[model samples]
Target: MTTQELLDQIRHKRSFLCVGLDVDLRKIPGHLLEEEDPIFAFNKAIIDATHHVAVAYKPNIAFYEAYGIKGWEALRKTIDYLNKNHPDIFTIADAKRGDIGNTSAMYARAFFEDLGFDSVTVAPYMGKDSVEPFLEFEDKHTILLALTSNQGAFDFQTKDSEGRELYKRVLETSREWKNSKNLMYVAGATKAEYLTDIRKIIPDSFLLVPGVGAQGGSLEDVCKYGMTKDIGLLVNSARGIIYASNGKDFASAAREEAEKLQAGMNAIMRQNI
Candidate 1:
């Protein structure tokens, strides 16, 4: 999906919520395990329930990769279903993938062409060449990891390198790469204060913010500090929404949770206006 298409969805839905489909077998309803493909079953239900309230869905690649071949199959099925059923909604392969240029091109094709994800999260630690390959795919996005939600991010990301914070340098440098207009960034919701600085570097770029809800990041703080005139934020909630219930009502439960977040987003947008 292009940026304008995504922005239109957010406007129509009155939301910028990105549901994370980080499915885990043990946490889903036991009844779903009886299905032929339990992970996809869970994801389909969550997507169906929350689709109206959500503008995007991000499936963390690690979750499926851990389950091996079956996981890979389920991942493919999930993306295909989204593309076929709800093409307007942005789909992200939360792969966090980056490698040497040749290998990165293969990874890009795997997600952008084969699986048909609208975007994929990539690590910038490999520098410009590793990321520019993913950016080559037109209208498809490469969301580079800048400052993450984890505690360990400070070890390298915030340190002074060449008289600027490492992440600040990253945001500054990545903008100069090939097809940089296709770039969006992964900025953790927990680091809302840093967003002021982040915005100074890339004021108009969209940010995919995780670490809300279950991670205890304040949604209000994120919007207050990070929101741009274009409402350039995709705040994600995974375990807090999908794992809201483990019974037959799980779908409805997820919907309710998503609705609550969407309502919050709506109110925030209104306040901004």
Candidate 2:
């Protein structure tokens, strides 16, 4: 989806909530396991319940890849369902893929053309060539990993090189790449303070922020530091929302959790206006 279209959805829904569909068979309701496609069934239920409150859904590729072919099929079905029913909602393939130019092109096509995701997460360590291929797709976004929520991120991302931190350089350098206007960033909500600096570098860019809820990132803090005039933030809650219950009430429970977050975002947006 185009950025303006996404922003319009946020306004219509009164939310910037991005529900993470990082499903784990071990954690889902046992009753779902009896279904033909357990994963897609679980996802469909959640989407149906929460789509009104959420503007986006991100499916972490690792969760599906671990289950192999069946897992991939489930993912495809989930995206197809979304496109067929809720095309206005942004879809993200949290694959974190980056490689040589040709390989990156293939990865881009796999997500953008084949699976039909509106965006995909990409690692930036491989530099311009690795990411440019993904950015080349018009109206599709490439969310590059910047300041991640993981503890190990500090080991390299915040390290000083010359006078600036590595991630700061990543933000600065990426803006100059071809089709850079398509770039968004992954700024972990756990590192909300870092967002103040991040926004200084890319004031208008949308940030795909994870690490809220279960990861202990404060939604209020993220809004304080990360929000832009366009409400440029997609705050994600994975386990906290999806795994809210492991019983038959899973989808209803997930919707309740999502509604809470969306309400919070709605309040923030109201105050901003």
Candidate 3:
């Protein structure tokens, strides 16, 4: 989807919630395992339950990759279901992929062309050549990992590099790449306070924030520092919402959790917009 279309979805739903479909078979309801494709079954139920409140869905690739071909097939079915049933909802492959230029091109085609994700999370460690291939796709987004929420983030992202923190340099240098407008970013909600400096660098780019709910990131602090007039944030919650229960009422429980987050987002929009 185009950025404007995403903004419209946020306005119409009064939410910028991105539900992370990071499923773990062991954590899902036991009954779902009876289905031929339990992963897709879990994801479909969650999406069906929460689609009205969520503007986007991100399927973390690692969880599926662990299951091998079965996992990949499930991921495809999940994306296909989303595309067919809720085309308006943005889809992100939480596949933090980036490599050499040619390899990156193949990775881009896999997610953007073959899998049909609206966006894919990319690691920028390889620099511009690794990222530009993803940006070349029209209407598809390349969400580069910036200041992440993990503790290990301090290892490099915040380190001084020629008078600038490395993450800031990543944000600055990326803007000059080909079709840079197709770029978005991943900023951890746990690093809410850091967003003040992050916003100053790319004040208007949409940020796919993951760390709220289960990760203990504050929605209020993230918005206070990161939000723009257009509501430029896709706050994600995975375990907190999807794993709210492992009972037969899992879907309903997931819906309730997502509604709670959506309400929080709606309230933030009311105050700011």
What are the TM-scores, per candidate, against the unseen true structure?
0.99, 0.99, 0.99
Model 3 spans with C-alpha error above 4 angstroms? none
Among all windows of ten consecutive residues in candidate 3, which has the lowest summed lDDT? 158-167
The model with the greatest lDDT is: 2
Better of 2 and 3 by lDDT: 2
The lDDT per prediction is 0.95, 0.96, 0.96
Question: Which pairs of residues have clashing backbones in candidate 1?
Answer: none
lDDT of 1 by residue, 108-141 (tens): 9999998999999999999999999999998999
User: Please, what are the lDDT tens digits per residue for candidate 3 over residues 1-273?
Assistant: 999999999999999999999989989999999999999999999999999999999999999999999999999999999999999999999999999999999999999999999999999899999999999999999999999989999999999846899999999999999999999999999999999999999999999999998889999999999999998899999999999999999999999999999999999999999
Candidate 2, 1-273: lDDT as tens digits: 899999999999999999999999999999999999999999999999999999999999999999999999999999999999999999999999999999999999999999999999999999999999999999999999999999999999998756899899999999999999999999999999999999999999999999999889999999999999999999999999999999999999999999999999999999995
Candidate achieving higher lDDT, 1 or 2: 2
